[model samples]
Target: MHAGFTLVEVAVVAGILGLLALTMTSAFEGMEQARQQNTAQAHAEAARQALRTFMLRNKRLPCPDNSTYGDRGREANGAGSCPGDLRVGWLPYESLGLQVPVRSQRLRYGVHRGTNADLVAPLHGAVDGPDLEGTGGLARALATAAQAAPSTDQPHYSGAVPALSSDTCASAEPVNPAFVLAAPATDRDVDGAIHPGFDGPNRGFATSSPCVAPPARPATRIYDDVVVAESATTLLGWLSTATR
Candidate 1:
């Protein structure tokens, strides 16, 4: 008998080798994805902690439900509104001395608000009625100054509020919900406007009918991968206080 390996034996060996290679490849991919998810979660927790600290100091939450007083748009007289600026990236966190990591992608921050018009004005203070009581000292000051000079015609500072239907927090008109943190998935329905960081014009994120887009490609922002699931998409702070 010829001392040669049979064809069947060779085929079996080849099949086993292929299976081993596939298993290794899958394991590597899974590990990478897990690592990414962990990193994103860590960032999220950091953001939350920063906001909590801000609340402790300010006697109110960093991103108030119905106000944009401390949002990125008004940061450091607009110095922190740049895309790479740590102030805008982390919102109120930056002021607390936290340094956001410089990842391949940027993060977006958002605020949580209710549908109450009186509480939160729509369109960055557009509907902010007269501060008759002068509750909002800043708004009152702006109103006083604007009235002093008729030629100035400067718009009064309005409170930040959502302009969406009561049924859905999504805005029927173009309005920017203050971002508290960056999201992971781009395809998710984003209710807020684009940050001045992302918007070339002064306006924040623009509006789209569907309000959902494809998964932000790798080059987008790091947090673009972190999506807010529809069921749990309500503002975290709001959820904490809900009766349910």
Candidate 2:
């Protein structure tokens, strides 16, 4: 009558098996996440190495300006421009012989400058005066010329300035010569708030704003890695390894 086992015993065994299955599922999820993280880290390191090699061969860093070669020149401050005599711009990792799959978004280098709203001068008083009136005339012509001229603070690689989102790091400026290595924030959310920075890995920009509040929350992922020619390179990240 009891050759197999009691109903109660069978039920208990089934429960134990279910618990084990649940535990195994959780373990597997953790392993998968770990693997993804390791892969991402390895890819990032490879990109860095490739960049180093490119610099070594060309004696300059690649500048990403949407394929435009406008910013190549020498500034009074000693900053190098894009498409310099060296002719290096947007060095593709594939060209460098890297096997990793290149992310389209990651492939882009340099900051994206938004439209020049400020360049258009606002209408002022005395519109009818000879000094200010006349479309297509000398007065109007001068105004248009002034607007078209490059900003005195424009960067050499891309005369355009970086778009200033509300989430930009408190310390970030329009033209930062040291942007690559500086801890200035560089990312914003859909709402234009800056993400929190990682505290551990110690990579990426540091925030000058308070840690609390809506837009001040830290970032959750790594961002673009910007390198300036013959200068320090800055890595933008969301969370620090330590904090993670």
Candidate 3:
């Protein structure tokens, strides 16, 4: 054999090194993603707790911001039930008056009372929670107010009424009073829409409409959504001291 290896041999060694580097890169990415997801979950819990605090202080949940995220109260009357076409929109981060929960420190919140076209975007293809559809899910609980007994309380709500069924839209008395939160992380593609989905391991979100719930699908370009939800019973339970 010659004193030194041929060009082909050196090429083979370089290729092997390249492949090894790629594998390590992918592994690191996976680990970072797991960490980010866990962090997002913690943030959601914090937001939920903050919401409870707001209710304790105000005796009622804050309304959706009229234009988009932030702001507070309602659009039509500045108080009472959220008013809008679907009554579904981004969460009132400023309204709730809670510090941003993520280390990145950005607004990551969404809510749906009844109407939010994006929640069910690609409506037919997207999967909806059995108990958390915009119409059949959170919206249904809200509908309870319509059929519920009138309120004697000053804040004035329908009080308790029957919850709605996703399939039949039937009532079950004492609606659960749940709502959806679309808390996506940051923008990845650099496109204006920053709903949810990871450009890298650093991104995470509570939920991004059209994908809804968990098991976010990257194939559908609907990854990075982290949905956090609460029922009226659980969320407003604190109200017992003030309202009940």
Candidate 4:
């Protein structure tokens, strides 16, 4: 007859297996977060280029989309409002004639309407209430997604929050936002529960002062608002250089 292994041996093997599984799981989570971060940054970069392209060709930024999801989220006319609260909102992605269903598409965007003196006055000409049309838009174009569960709130993605303002912490602070993007570092609705960090009550609104430099990791109360600060003056500068 063959002798079987002792109970301790079995327990030890089980422990080893559990540890290995945990290690693998952790690794996967890190990889996913990193991918999301890169994708968010990519979206921001693309938007910056898109805004510049639109300005170069049309001499003005396209208005933000004001309609709801049903209408493709674009302004009916040149009269859309991104609300005073957000200081930003869904950009007129369609009007800009950009490709839809972008790889890891940006969920939403915010732009200063030339209100914050610090962000706009520096530009030397950009004005306030530069409101554009925008309604919260697609996680990806023409689709509804369920996050965490079948009946849970669908989570949105993250992007670059470029601003021109001096104080990032104060909300209700307006600026001449020139189409900046922002993303949630975490699930906006965590398993059907609302969550902060990366995505919070102020999804695109970063209430951190001095536009605190974005962290390499995800968003937190302290360093959650990752933004990119650009101004009309900067655009004008770019224009001048391009024309030269």
Worst 10 residues of 2 by lDDT: 233-242
Query: 111-170, model 3: which lDDT tens digit per residue?
Result: 333322212121222235442222233233333433344222111112223122111212
- What is the C-alpha lDDT profile of model 4 across 1-244, one tens digit per residue? 7499789999999999999999999898767666665666666677678767765554444554544321354533543342433333455667666654431243354443332221111222222333222111211111111111121011121224434222222233223333445544445333232213434333323332112232222443223334444544566557556545
The true-versus-predicted C-alpha distance at residue 179 of model 4, in Å, is: 3.9
List RMSD in Å for every model shown: 12.6, 17.1, 13.2, 12.7
Ten contiguous residues minimizing lDDT sum, candidate 4: 134-143
Error of 3 at 156 (Å): 24
Best by lDDT: 4
lDDT ranking, high to low: 4, 3, 1, 2
Per-residue alpha-carbon lDDT of model 1 for 1-244, expressed as tens digits?
9799799999999999999999999898666656665566566566666655453333223322111323332233332222221212224345545663442223444332222211112222323565342234323222333233211011111122422222132323322222334433232223344432222111221221212111222322222344221111233234334312
Model 2 over residues 157-219: C-alpha lDDT tens digits? Answer: 222333322223222222222112212122322223222222211121222211111111233
TM-score of 2: 0.36
For candidate 3, which ten residues in a row score worst on lDDT? 150-159
Score each candidate by Cα lDDT: 0.34, 0.31, 0.40, 0.41
TM-score, cand. 1: 0.43
